[model samples]
Every structure is written in C-alpha cells, then in structure tokens.
Target: MVGARFFNFILFFAGLAVAFNVKTIPLNADHYVKVLVLFWLFSTMYHHLRVLHKTGNTTVDYGISYSLSFGIFAGPLGLFIFETIYRFTVYFNKKRTGTDDPEEFSDTFYNIGAFVLTYSAAYYLYNLLRPVFELFPFGYWILIFLLVCITSLLIDLLLIIVFLLTSDIKTVREAVDFIKSRSILDMGKTAFTNGLLLLFLREGEWGALFALFFLNYLVSRSFYSKSQSIKNKIERDKFEQMAYTDFLTGANNRAFMDKRMAELDETGEYIGIVVADIDNFKHINDTYNHSVGDQVIRHFAKTLKSYINGNDNLFRSGGEEFTLFLRNRNYRQCLDLVERIRRGIEESAVEAEYGPGTASISYTSSFGLYFYRIHHKVSMEKGYIQADQLLLTSKQHGRNRITALDGSNKQGNMPVSIPKQKLVP
Candidate 1:
C-alpha cells in the first residue's frame, strides 16, 4: 500500500539522480551507452518496487543486482531501462510461492533475469555502436562479455537459492537479517573467488579487480558482528532451556520450579505443592527390571501432566518422585486433585511391552500434598523438605495413599493420611 508506493518512488528518484550525473559524450557511441545505462536503472527500480510490494522492504540482494546493472550499462540510461523491464516482466503475472509472496520471489528472479538480458543487450549494443567509432578493441570486448556471463551465472545461482529458501518470510528486513546472520561468509567467499579470477587472469585490469576483491573483503568483514550477535542469542536460548528442562521426562525440572516459587513469593499468591512417588518403586525395578521401571516412570509423568491446571507446573524432581506447583489453590482442592491422580494411575494399565498386550505392565503411585498459604514465607527448599516428610509418612504407614499437611504454622505437622486403595492388575 502506502509503504510499497513510497519505497518504489524513492528507488525511482534515486536512480534518476544517479542517471543524471553520469558523464555523457555527444558522440553516437557514448549516447548509446548512456541509453543502456538509463534502461538498466529504470528496470532495477521497477524490480525493486515489485520486491517492496511482496516483502515490504528492499534488501542486499536487490542492491547487489543494482550494482551489477551499473557495471553492465556503464551509464545511467542503460541501467534504468534494464531495471524497468526487469520490474514488469518478472512481476506482472507472477504467482505467490509457499516460501514467498508473489512479489518478492518475482523481484529476485527478475533481478537475476534482467541482469542476464541487459548484460547481453548492452554488450551487443556496445559492439555494434563501437564499430562505427572504431572504439573498444576485440580483446577488451571479449573479456568483458566473458566476465559478465561468468559473474552473472554465479550470482544468479546463489541468489536463486536464497530467494527460494526465504520467500515465505514476511519482510525484506527478516530476509536480510537471515542472510546477514547466517550466509554472509559463504557469499563473501564466492565474491572473493570471482574477484580473484578477474584480478589474476584478466591482464591490465588488476586495479579494478583488486578494488572488487577489497570490496568483497570489506563486505565479509562487516558480517562478523552480526554473526557473533546471532550466535550469542542462540547460545543464550539453549542455556535457558537447559536450565529449566528435564531431559528424561520432557517436564520442568527443579530449577524451573524454584524460579516459579520466587515469582509466587513475590506476588504472595496461594500455591499447592503436591509431591508424588511411585509406590514400592524399588520392588517394581527388582521384579520387572530397570527398563520396565523406566517405562513406568515415563508413563506416570505423561498421565500426571493430563490432570494439571493450565497454570500449574509438573516436575520430575528425582527417580520415582515428582512435584506439582498449583497456583492460587488451597489444601482441600489439592487433596482432591491428588486423589484423582492416584485413582487414574491405579486404574490405568501400562503395557510392559513397548508393543502389544502380550508384554504389558502395570504400575501405581502414592502422593504427598501440601498447600502454600499467602501468610507463609518459606523457601522452596523448606517446602520440599516438609513435603518429603509427608512422603516418608505415606511410605511408612502404607503405600498407594494420599497424605496432606494441614494449613498450619507449626513446623512439624504429622501426615493427614487416606485409606490404602488396592490397584487392579
């Protein structure tokens, strides 16, 4: 919309200003080169406008292609015409690809296509017009044409892949960010190689070739900061995830719960802490083997997750032990939740066989429950100790039961026990 039109206008005016500043000779050959330059500029501007329409921004890809067009035309007029056709031909009837909106991919494709066409056209025009003035020796002409083809092909291949990969992205800003952060080194290497070829093989052109190589070096150097920045971001994210996650159960770990407790304390919110342990866990591993015990632990973790509130967190604190942090919940309601979890584990059968019914196994869990009070100012370590004391009580009295601590200030509260419920095999 307004943004697209604004960018298009900007590109057009900027190209025009550049075009007007080009050196012009009154002679026929000079005039023709100038025309080609104008064409190159216009075509490039048009293509960029198409890019803006699709991706909402212009990028380094577009800028590089524009620079190549400048090299091809050697004058503003040729550049304008080539760019203008590129804009119209590539974008006029382009369909959107899954990777990119129609406009962006089209603009990239057209930029590449336009370079091929304009370079071909400009070279041909130069040859035809130069014959009249006996300018541009055959050796020089052949070298330019050969170099143009090689450079265009290389740039096209690289840019085409980038376009295909990134078209689906929302904006040119994101696309460029991706390139800057991830792919710049590869591009710089390619540019360096190409520049090296021009410097070493093309006699008498070492100065220009060296300039291009230096430009490539500078471009490569520019990306070091961006690449390091992205690397830091990725590393930071990975560290954060590792800090909070249990690799075995894919559940929150103790560190994550501790952080949540800090938040709860700051808010002075009510929370229910439920500690659960697999009943006679040692016996199960001894009876069926450790592998089966592992399966039971995984199954228990998955089942427990289903019964939790949206805001609640489930943690695998240790072997056969888990903790749930339920926000804004009281002791009675937490007891009810614990009972339901117990019943669920008691009734559900886990197939010992990772496969069919023939190898199935069954397991059950006992829970220790405690609710946090707004008036309580205890640390997570102390809360966990209190819950562990209740768990020992459950194990000592009988397995497969729920034991809760009353909402009391007295530090050593006895376990509030439930009846032993037998689980069906």
Candidate 2:
C-alpha cells in the first residue's frame, strides 16, 4: 500500500509539471484538436487489436500514438491530455467488463510517468541541439533525431529498471539483463518513422501527414496480427508438451514412449527396452505419506536421468514404474547403463517431510532389460512384456537386482529371461 501511494504521488506531481509546461507554451487550440483526433484514431485502433493475457494482464501496446504526438510538435501538455484520455477510455472499458483491477490503474499512472519523463527529456535535448543541427547540412537532422530517440529510450529503460526495483518484480541485475536482450533495432525504426513524420509536419504538408498516419495504422495492424499468430503457436506447443510430460517426476509420460516406439519402428532400428521399479514403494507411501512417496519418486527419476546419454529416452510408464528406450545400443551396453543407474539410486537419499521434521530415506530399485532388432518380427509391446517379466524375476529374487536377457536370446521367438544378479549393498 505504501508503494502504491508513492507511485500515485509521483504521478500527481508529474501530471502537474506537464500541465504547467503546456500553459507556458503558446496555445494552438486548432492544431491541438487536429493532433488529438489523429492520436485518438490510432489509439482506438491499437486498443482493440491489443492482446490480453488469459490472466487478465495486458502486454504493453506499441507507442506509435506517443511517437506521433512527439512527431507533430505536440508539447508536453498535448501528450499528457492524449495519455489521460487514453487511460480513462481503457479504464472504463475494463470496468464495463468487470476486469478493472487496481493494479491496472497503478500501471496506467506508471506508464504516464514514464512517457512524461521520456518526452520531457527528449524535448529539452532537441532544443539544446537545434542550433548545432542548423550548422550542419540537411541530412544531419537525422543525427539530431537519432540522439533524441536514444535519450528517450535510455530514460524509458531507466524508469523500467526503477519500476522493477520498486515493485519487486526483479532484481537490478535481472532488469538490466532484460533490457540488454531487447532489440535496439526496433526502437531505432520507430524513431526513424517519427523523425520522417516530424519533417513533413514542419513543412505543413497535411496530405503527407495523413498518409503517414494511415501507413502507421496499417503497420500496427500487421504487427498485431503477427504477434497474435506467434502467441497462438507458443500456446499450442505448451499444450503439446504438457500432454506428453509426467506431472509427478518430470519425465516423459507413457504416451510419449508409445509415439517414439512408432517412430523407431518406421526406421527399423534395433532398440533396447529397460523397465525399472522402485522396490517397496508402497511401504514408503504407507510409512510416510503420498507426499514423501512423490519426493522419493522425483529423486529416483533425477538419478535415472543422470545415466541417460545421446538417443536414450526415459519415461514414467506409470506409478513406481519407469521405462528407458536405448537406440543403437546392444544388450551388454544397456545392461551396464541400467546397472549403473540402479547403483546410483541405491546410493541416493531423499529428504522426506513427515509431521514436524524431515528424515533422509535411502531406497533401492530393480531393473529388467531386453534388446530386440525391429525388423526381426518382434513388436515393441513384446519387448516391453519381456522386460516386465525380467523385472518381476528381479523382485522375486529379492529387490535391488538386475534381470536382463542375454544377447544370444535377442532373436528368440518368445520372451526369455536370463539369471538374476542380486546387487544388495
């Protein structure tokens, strides 16, 4: 609440300063009306095209309207009025939809403060450089324009950093890094367009001004359309990823394994399948709780991931069960990898919370590995069944063991399990 009040106070004073600057400048009511109409049109168009996040947060709309205000020699007063009207319009629109959040109001003030400060600094620098600019040839005006644009961009970036700090949105280093990653080329393009419009406005060519306004409107529409398309693509990718990702262990889910199996079959590649199960997982769940059991599962999954190399995929097949797909690896290699993972799991301890304290719990797992060539008339399901049978054999032999089919049995017509190797520590 104190921070909110501080932001409001800054906005009040900033508004006063802008209002005072307007009073000092010669009143051109007619020109102000003309600029206001043009600004309002662009603002309205951009407003409707703006994208609103599902969370009700809105992305920052492009500052084409503000750029035009500066281009037309609209003093600080004109820009302030334009911003005020725009804010009120947005506020009322959101109010009608019952989405007018208090934070939105604060954001409006924040944006207004940013604009006034940036434009004020740019106006001051423009005046300071005008004489020096006149001494140079005509094309040198671009330099003055570039410098003023840089000043505005720098001030805007500084205010964004300050906002990040005050609102606790990010640390100073993070804010700086964010600004550094932004595209300066985009900023320069906007400034160059504004500079061109400024030149036309100075020459009193109303036709060119209106034409440029239309062109800017079209450009904004194009950008809005492209941004919407990109946003949709990102959303679709996120959904696809979620569909195939395990919620508990962060491994690929069974569905993903099925898809990969189909793809591997099409390529007719020899693949090794390994099935692993945490020994006595139900005992862990009953001794502690499901939460502790989940922790153990996640820890075990992390250990399993450590053993994966190129072209090796791990999946959470179901509760307490995991599957690994090893491509182009023979039975011996797969057996060695799974044995290493089983040893790693045994050595790993998970911190599980219980009631008032946390306790480190050591756990063990059993693995079953089977290797098969795709073109040898063996199905992926048959391979998984063979591995599952070996996994059961390990569990029966006493948990924490590996039961893998020998390489010589790879071409067998039926499922075959070799002798189990107990790895109890």
Candidate 3:
C-alpha cells in the first residue's frame, strides 16, 4: 500500500514538472501535446531499460525496440498504431506459450487500448471544438458540445465493444462479460469523454493539455497494469510456495520432499533421510489447547529447519512429524546433523501467537536418521519404509532425541550397528 501510494505521488509530481517545463517550449497546444507525448514514450522506454538491467530480461529489449519504433512512426495515429500492434503481439505470444486460457492478455490489451482510443478521440474532439469556439455564435457552442458528447460516446462505445470482442479475449471473456454486464464500459467511455471536455474547458485548446491527459492516463494505466500483474504474480508465487510448504509448520510439505528425493535419486546422489516427530504431541493436544499444541509443533518444525544446511530439505509429513532430506551425507554425518537439529529444537524458543508464554516457549523434537544408499538397488518406497522403521525405533527406545540405523543416540556421537530385521517384505 505504501509502495503504491509512493508511486502515485512520484508520477503526479513528475507529470506536473514535465508540464511546467514544457510550458516554456513555445509551440501551440497541439504541438506541445506531441512533445509531452514523446516524453511519455521516452519515460516508458527508460522504465523498460531499468527493468532489463535489473532482471536481465532480453524481452525488455524487444519492448524497447517496439516502443522506439512505435514512437517514431506513431504520430497522430499513436494510440491506434501502438494498440493494434500490441494486441497482435500479445495474441501471438499467448498462442506460442501454450497456455490454456491467457485471459490476462485480453483484459490488459482491451482495457488499455480502450483507454488510449478514448483519450486520442477526446483530444481530437477538443481540437475540433477549438475552431467552433473561435467561429461559431452563442447557442451554437452548446449544440456542438451536446453533439460532440453524443457522437464521441457512440464512437467510444463502438471502440470498447470492438476491443472486448476481439484480441486474445477467450481467457478474459468472463471478465469482459462481467464488465459489460455491469455497464462499466459504457460508464467508462462517458466518464473519459466528459473528462476530456473538461480538460478543453480548462485550457480552451486541445494541444499540450491533451498530452497531459495522455501522460496522466499512460502513467495511471502503466501503474494499474504493473500493480495488477504484480498482485497476480504474487498470488501465483505464494500459491506455489504454499503448495510445496507445510501449512502448520511452514516447512516443505510431503509432496515437495518426494519431489526432492526423486531428483536426488535420479542423479544417484547420496542422501540421509531423517524423519522427526514431536514427543507426546498427542498428549499436548489433549492436555493443553490444540492451539498451544499447534504452536509447539510449529516451534519444533522451525527449530529443525534452522539446523539444516542450504542443500537440506525439511518437510512436515503430517501431525507432529517431519521428514528431512540431506544430500551428499553418510550415516554418521546424518546422525550428527540430526543431533544438531534435535538440540536446536530443545534449546530454541518460539513465540506463542495464541499460547501461554511470557514471550514464547521452547519445544523439543526427536529425530530418526536413515542412510539412503543411492548405489543400492532399493526402491524409493522401501527406502522410505526403512527410514520410518528407524523413526519407530527412535520412539520405542526414548523420546526427545535422535536415532539412526547405526543405533547412535543424539548425545553420543559413536555409531551403533543396526539390528538386521526384515520389517517389510
């Protein structure tokens, strides 16, 4: 919100400054409008350049070339020329990308194009009226004004309908339907045409002032598109993050763990699988509030995450239990890793958002480590079972500690041989 407000302020101030500076440029309002329009084109180009430099997106270069070419040849046909090309490009790109319904392109292209056409027409209308005020008598101006509104509204409505109907509209057809359903397109056109009339009223000419409207719309439209795009991307990115993340613990969820494991397996990379569980979690839920119990679980998960290396994966499989996948590590190394994680959870504190604590309470966790030998001819399902068995052994012996296939305890760093038993056939 703060960012959006700041951007608005920046654009507003920048427009005023651009206007004040251009006022000195000694051209009729029409020519002055063109100058400022050029400014807008340059400003947009600069913005694209900044994006390209920051993100290393070669696509921005394409945009830069497009803008430059459009700016050079666009002239009085600026809105129509640019929009027609832009819509075509977006339509083609959507087709190439293989998206089922690229609805955003339709909404964006149509909405933006509608706005541009409206502004351009308004500019022309205002210019057309200038000769009227200079030549026409009293009641004639009123008639022209009313006639202009009606005519412009008709044209604006037709343009709006055309845009909504055409372009990459399949994805956004519903949105278009809804917009048209609510009569917003009609309302928007009326509002915009009226706004341009008011602009003419303010300055008594269509020249530089029309360009001001154009600048204002360009800035506003750019901001709106960027913000909406960012919001959508944020939603998609957040969902992607959440899809892989555990809801309760905010760790990687089971599905994500499986994905990582499969990748490691495919590459024949050695990984230690540690399955950790909170001690007496069920009792905690039964004794304290489930909410507090949830906090404890969350704390345990976070602590476990803190102990892992960058290459390691920590996932919550279900209630009170988590799975860890660490790459390029042996049984002993895995044991040490699990022990560190267990100790971290035992010692670390977690702030209770809805639980009892001065500030927060600490929780402990027990972990079971199993060496997953990629070299061994074992199925992934079998390896997971082996890891689970190690977890069961850890719980059976004691809680609040680490247990490995080597039988090494969390406190003692020494390795212990696994008791060979074919738990799963």
Please name the candidate that would achieve the greatest TM-score relative to the true structure. 2
* After superposition, candidate 3 runs with Cα above 4 Å error: 1-238, 349-362, 406-425
CA lDDT of each prediction against the hidden true structure: 0.59, 0.71, 0.54
Per-residue lDDT for 1-425 in model 1, tens only? 34443433544555555544554422366544544444344443333332121222334333233334244434444445445555555445343323344345434444434444444444345446545444546544344444445554544444434344555455667546544443443434434453343334224354554455456445544554566688799999999989899877788888887887777666665667788889878987887778778888888999999999788889988888999887666666777778888998988987765433434666677777776664456765567777877777777777788778765435855567785553211
Q: Residue 197 in candidate 3 has what lDDT? A: 38
* C-alpha lDDT (0 to 100) for residue 412 of candidate 2: 50
Worst 10-residue lDDT window for candidate 2 reads 53-62
lDDT of 2 at 28: 74
Candidate 2 global CA lDDT score: 0.71
- The better-scoring model by lDDT among 1 and 2 is 2
Better of 1 and 3 by lDDT: 1
The model with the greater TM-score, 1 or 2, is 2
Model 2 / residue 269 / CA error / Å: 2.9
lDDT of 3: 0.54
In model 2, the runs with Cα more than 4 Å from the true position are 1-32, 47-62, 65-72, 76-81, 84-87, 93-99, 103-125, 137-183, 283-295, 340-363, 375-378, 406-425
lDDT of 1 at 407: 51
Compose the digit string of candidate 3's lDDT tens values, residues 1-425: 23323433443344334334333333355744554454355434333222321111111111111221122222224534344444455455546767314343433344334434444444445457656665666533453345444444543354333433443123456444433442334344434444443445345564654564465557646865796799799999999898998777778888887787676666666667778788777776776677888888877776777777788778888788888777767766776667666666666776666544433655566666766556447645556667787778767766675556632234534323232221211
Ranking by lDDT: 2, 1, 3
What is candidate 1's TM-score against the reference? 0.51
